[model samples]
Target: MSKILIIEDEAAIRRVLVKILNEENGDYIVEEAEDGLSGIEKLKKDDYDLVLCDIKMPKMDGVEVLEAVKKIKPEIPFVMISGHGDLETAVNTMKMGAYDYISKPPDLNRLLNTVRNALDKKELVQENKRLKKKVSKHFEMIGESESINLVKEMIEKVATTDARVLITGPNGTGKELVAHWLHQKSDRSKKPMIEVNCAAIPSELIESELFGHVKGAFTSAVKDRAGKFEAANGGTIFLDEIGDMSLSAQAKVLRALQENKISRVGSDKDIKVDVRVIAATNKDLQKEIEKGKFREDLYHRLAVILIKVPALNDRREDIPLLIKHFAAKVASEQGTIEKEFTDNAIKLLQEYDWTGNIRELRNVVERLIILGNKEVSEADVKLFASK
Candidate 1:
């Protein structure tokens, strides 16, 4: 249900707003305040999804209320109420962060549409906040080794800029983690970080997937759709396994990098996008370029800042910490007690070759947690952790 607060000095206007909102939808729980001072008091006491305030209140005005609310609860959408003479003031309120303004004797259609749009924006904002928290929790860089520290230091230096990054590493060495870290630390963290696995999509459809298509663009195209670049405007787009991208798509990607624009698969018009590109691949792009499979110019465009994540076997000292981290993570996820790996068990596990990198180690840790004894021992590692 959406909670709406109406702050108008006029009793009749407040009643009208309450009636219109309550009758428009049963889910709308409308509340009223006689003046801006009372309105702010109510706001402090309760959470509101939207606020409609009159510009000319007796004790406090809409402008003052808006400024106050911005400091305390900036997420709530504000709609200013304006009389004929207050139209200029109402317009100014928008620049001060009011969502929109409605003239006195509100038009039902305009009022309802504004309210719906504001509520939708509020929902989107809240969802973004939730996803950011989830990303921060799930993608933590859980090592303090020199190799990992170098990657961390590089991210700190480059994340503040819009420079394109190319992350090169073996499979499962946490290349994606580095991408997420770059995005989260960057100024575009509020916007989305869209991820596309270039190798996972079919070669024939990769172009359409990166640059959207209009209806009838292909046999499967039923309607016009936006692609990852469009969706990631004002944000970051992580292209994983970019080495596998087809040459046709590579040309289009290069064009976008050069001009900051892309044409839909079937459309002649180009759409301008302000997106930060971050690409990752396990394959050696220089080798791919020599083999004529990858574009050299495209590689140069994406590799403005190169970050190579070290494989797990190269940083064996972090294995014990990783095991403990994974054990606690598995216990929390599975609703069980965290298991402790014996020192000998960790040493033995560290000595083993981890060709599959961090991804394989996480799977093995989870398996041992389930199959090993209360305390994971070297014997359990030998039994359940065989390559």
Candidate 2:
């Protein structure tokens, strides 16, 4: 069911609009306001899915009413109803946040279709708000090492701005984790956080994946579709493994970063997007640039805030703390008492190279918990966690 408000100075026009809405469907809950001031008052008092406002009105006028309604309920869609003389004002109303403008006397079919579309858009906005809340709640950064702490501090400082962030680290070193935290903490956190793995998607499809294509744009493009940039409007996009992106895709990615616009592979028209991009790469992009595999200008665009995650081996002092954390986690998962690591066991384990970083240590901890005796000993590491 939809709740609609009709705000018109002319009593007969308001009544006619109400009748059409009621006849189109009883599922509509129709309400009326005879003037702009009264309409804004009504809007404040109740939650309406859509508002239909006439341009010429007493005291406040439709423009005033639309502006006020925007401040009050930004997501509630408004459709302007205008007389032939109100065409210019109606167009202005749309620029002032009206969902659309309809010239009066209202066409019955057009009124119903506009109402349906406005209500649908309202639902999408509501769903987007809900998803944003969920994303903000879930993407919390959990760590206490100096490196992790520095990352958190930087995120706090930079999250409110639209600067590009480039995260560099080894696999499972949680570059993705940092990217998610940046978005979740940012001003755009209330909108979608679209993520794409440059390495995972096929090279041919990467362009279509970032910028949507029209129907018949290419083979396998069975229908028109919106791309990630369009989908992430007023939001953030995390491009993971950017170093591995195809050269052709890099060109498009660079354009989007440079001009804040992108073009679908088969389309010549450029689509403008308001997206804040945070990218991650495992390889040294400078080295890739030297080898003629990466773009230098693009590197500068993405490295506005370069954060290099220290490899677990480089941060060995934090290993014992991490080991304890993982031990408790693994013990809970396995439903058994956590094995205590003797000081010797901790030292012996830390001395070995952590080629796989934090990820490998976590696996070793699981092995220790499942296979070791009452208390894990230095000998236990030798027996169960060799290399």
Cα deviation at 322, candidate 1, in Å, is: 0.4
lDDT of 1 by residue, 1-387 (tens): 999999999999988888889889999999999999999999999999999999999888999999999999989999999999999999999999999999989999999999999999999988876664444768888888999999989998898689999999999999999999889977799898999999999999999999999999999999999999999999999999999999999999999999999999999999999999999999999999999999999999999999999999889989988999999999999999999999999999999999999999999999999999999999999999987
In lDDT terms, how accurate is model 2? Answer: 0.86
Which whole-number lDDT from 0 to 100 does residue 257 have in model 1?
99
Question: How much is 370 displaced in model 2, in angstroms?
Answer: 2.4
Residues 107-206 of candidate 2: C-alpha lDDT, one tens digit per residue: 9989888889989888987777556434342344446778778877887678768999999999877788788877876778879989999999998888
Off by over 4 Å in 1: 1-135
Model 2 ranges with Cα > 4 A deviation:
1-145, 334-337
lDDT of each: 0.94, 0.86
Please give me the total number of clashing residue pairs in predicted model 1.
0
TM-score of each: 0.67, 0.62
Name every residue pair that clashes in candidate 2: none
